[model samples]
Target: MDGHRIRVGTASWTDPSLIQCKRFYPPGCTSAEGRLRYYADKFPLVEVDSSYYALPSARNAHAWVERTPDDFAFNLKAFRLFTGHQTPAKALPKDVQQALAGHFAVKKNLYYKDTPAEIRDLLWHRFENAVRPLREAGKLRALHFQFAPWVTRSARAQDHILECQRRLAGYHLAVEFRHRSWFEGDAAGDTLAFERAHDLTHVVVDEPQGFENSIPTVWAVTSPKLAILRLHGRNAATWNIGGEAASDRFNYDYSDAELGALVAPLRETASLAGETHAIFNNNYGDQGQRNAATLQALLDGA
Candidate 1:
């Protein structure tokens, strides 16, 4: 850790399960701002998961900046619609939905390509404005774009990724590919090369293996500036199931043995990268906070 700054934290601090756990926060700290302050005191970094489900507001970003310490940082997930995911019409802005109605009959869902160029540009503008408060406060760590499984290895997909980078220019962007094809056979090298060439950080994932959509836990570091490791617990039974909430899919808790095994690899990654973040995404009950604390303790003792 001599040349690297390693931070350990969870993907979220306000999940329903986390709040219901009632152990992390004090009895008096019941408000959202209080929860953030309590979490920031324990962990130096966090990933804002709620932004992926809904549009992030500047008011909330400003509140986050005001609540946390100057050294606290947040990595936010880009909106689902901007990352090639099927976003529901109800989740969009009212004005945007009305504009879409003028073009076609109301559809329940909309893809990225479904929106016209002008509407997409407006979305980008709104997203930038929403996160500006965090950026100006020096609290924004990175903007994560976790692409859909359908966005595979192809010329069009490649071009669209470059287009995404262009649209969200001037921000430290990290790319996470859910599709297995991006690293299948000889394509892995090409994918790393692409990330390096574009100056995008590659998000390494630890998930249940053997599933078609499960990305292999490749430990390569594409960016020397920042390296992100997301530990989505190995719950294979529900990883690809439908009609379940995100918390259920990532429900497994890491045992002490599992956390101990990660110490060396995490330290190795930190040594090579300028900054490294290990985010525990297991949102079931109090597992995420427990594992994150355990890992941080191990790192500190080492």
Candidate 2:
């Protein structure tokens, strides 16, 4: 880490608003190499959100390495199911094959449209293995196992996280809770204790309403260690909105004041924790880039 805050960079350089605004890089200006270079030239860290879906190419990873400085860091969100969502399964108990979803092989059932838990485990396992190369290369900062909306402060969820932490060979696991129950006094303390016990950093989020996402937000719960902060530029009206989706609200710019609100907390967290990752999901035309620049200025001046 460079002072109290080692480095700060956008989750993605190609955010919609960045292309539209040309704050740092021009619109339509990123390839894996280009984007890596762009961030390496500015701040020294970034969040690789693309890996949350399909497996990325080895060449892509190498390109990222080629473009980055030695001190740069990358954080990845682990595969969806490994975080404790159903593995697409047959009557499996919590303590048994829970986090081991990655170990099972999914047998095809022609009768069903959805994937079976067995098959899902195989898939999630493959996904987890694929991410290892990055970690092996020293590119990974943390693997965030952000649980879905249904995961609560139940014993099963807690046990599942512990199991995953135990099995996850050589990675740092951070858990993000979506349901409100995970934050109640007893539950919240237990959850934070779990993180501290395993040395796992927690994911912090500042989401917009209507999304019905995590309560207590990851930001509020995070310890001052390594952290992932998601800023979901909120528009309560659009929380559950689904339609032709005309005139998006997220594309709106984050004014200096709004950016200031987030930056302040993050600065304090970084100072306290000794390191931090602040990611913006505002994702408007070029607003994220402008905000990243504004944030970088604040960090540099700090």
Lowest-scoring 10 consecutive residues by lDDT in candidate 1? 101-110
TM-score of each: 0.96, 0.76
- lDDT string for model 1 (1-302, tens) is 23589999999899988888887888988999889989999999999988888889999999999999998989999999988998887778889988888544756788989889898999888989999999999888799898887888888988988887888777888988898998898999999999988888889899998866778988878888789999999999989878636788898989988988888888888888888999999988789999999999988988
- Candidate 2 lDDT over 121-143, as tens digits, reads 56546656666667777777777
lDDT score for candidate 2 against the true structure: 0.63
In angstroms, how far off is 292's CA in candidate 1?
0.2
- Residue 26 local lDDT, model 1: 85
**Scored by CA lDDT, what does every candidate get?**
0.88, 0.63
Question: By TM-score, how accurate is candidate 1?
Answer: 0.96
Candidate 2 displacement at residue 255 in angstroms: 2.2
